[model samples]
Target: MAEFLSLAEAVRRTLRDGDTVAFEGFTHLIPHAAAHETIRQGIKDLALIRMTPDIIYDQMIGMGLARKVVFSYAGNPGVGLLRRMRDAIENAYPRAIDTVEHSHSAMAQAYEAGAAGLPLAVFRGYKGADLPKVNPDIRFVTCPFTGEQLAAVPAHRPDVTVIHAQKASRKGDVLIEGIIGVQKEAALAAKRVLVTVEEVVPDFRGLHPNLCILPHWTIDAIAVVPGGAHPSYTHGYYARDNKAYLEWDGISADREAFAAWMRDNVLTVGPEIFAERVKGL
Candidate 1:
């Protein structure tokens, strides 16, 4: 059963140093609040896993929490590069983190393989793709049945998985309604799952048809946190805070500016500040 806990408690209890953690959401319902709590707790040496490493991972990486990052595409959505990540990779500012890059298809298949408890994800991909040369983790396997070469990547079985959802019933079943991504696979593949939601209602009985519902049995913790997906948006709750994204380009541009921004915005604030993020919507 999923136990309802505070954001701080959930993050502290669920994550540890050197753990592989996945915070997943496609474009919406990204778990920014949970990521913030992880940063505030000062967890370190994480192998961060995400299909797209956006501002959330950028902030974590900027804090020097990550030792390695595995992802497909990494950048601020609609913005240019992730400046903090660039600083870490290019200049070794704060810390130098190792990166494992893969194709979008490879990542998707890897998550599926993880969810299936498989050792490696195999799919017909990377044909004429040079990613294998640069990423040693990417390998080719010949199918015995078909005699066709296919790409393979190790499954992503994270130590912990965190995601933001639109709502959850008092029973702790999560409801996510929007551009559904691999959050489901990521959560199922992890040893532990923490779901932060905008609100917890009596029951999500009426919100069933279109909403992707994860039964409480699949999750370990539930936290009620409005606007948990800040800079990123929730489907029905608020519009994307494009202003924050644009502003972050400036805030994360320089080392001093990024540190100042983290101190002022993330390190000092609690979960309550999340509600203030989308006041108008």
Candidate 2:
């Protein structure tokens, strides 16, 4: 039997103070609604882990929800650095634990190692570069036979993996499009997995078998939320909320405006209010 929960309940069940949460999706395709809900509920001491952190990270930091973040880059979607994130770094208020800048391919490989229960994965990208500078924890190993130096990235087992998908079954099977490396690996490596989907189908039979990215057994909870990935997109569905993001980008530049936005949209507003505000968007 599988457990079905609302997005809020799923987040409440999986997240805790001082937990390391691995979030799926890229910059514009991030799961902001759930993250926002987490912040609204006041889940403190969160450590965010991502290949590249962006506006969502900045918002979390701005709202004082994130205590630590491990990532390679933090910036706006198309614009360069995110203002609030830059402010956070410049002031050194919310601590940042930086990591090596790796291509999406390399990041997938590292998470794959964690999923496969391996100690580390050896790759060839560490020579004569600044990667080692960002991630000093990565080890440099030489093959005995080839005498070739390689970068060994250790497995990262996060406390929780929160991914927003296009569709899910009542039994917890998830359907995601495009690359499933991070989502798949995170599902396998994390102690618990919480999936928020735009729609909940009766069963897997209605969905294309090939589109089923994750099986039900891997998910601890399945949350049915229509706009779960707002500010992000669901493949074959709606596009990201670019207008909302642009608004956030503009207001986030000013401390007073950012605080007000957070208070109105995030702190005071509940899920119902958020849904109402984004009804036409």
lDDT of 2 by residue, 117-171 (tens): 8878778875787766776656789998999888887776788888878777666
lDDT of 1 by residue, 1-281 (tens): 79999999989888999999999999899999999999999999999999999999999999999999999999999988899999999989789999999988888889899999998999988889888889999999999999999888999899999999988898888888889899999998999999999998998665558668889999999999998998799988998988888988998998899989899889999999999877986
Model 1 RMSD, rounded to 1 decimal = 1.0
**Poorly placed runs, candidate 2 (over 4 Å):** 27-29, 94-103, 179-181, 273-281
C-alpha lDDT of residue 60 in model 2: 82
My TM-score estimates for the predictions, one after another, are 0.98, 0.89
192, model 1: CA deviation in Å? 0.6
Candidate 2 Cα lDDT to native: 0.72
Q: How does candidate 2 fare on TM-score?
A: 0.89
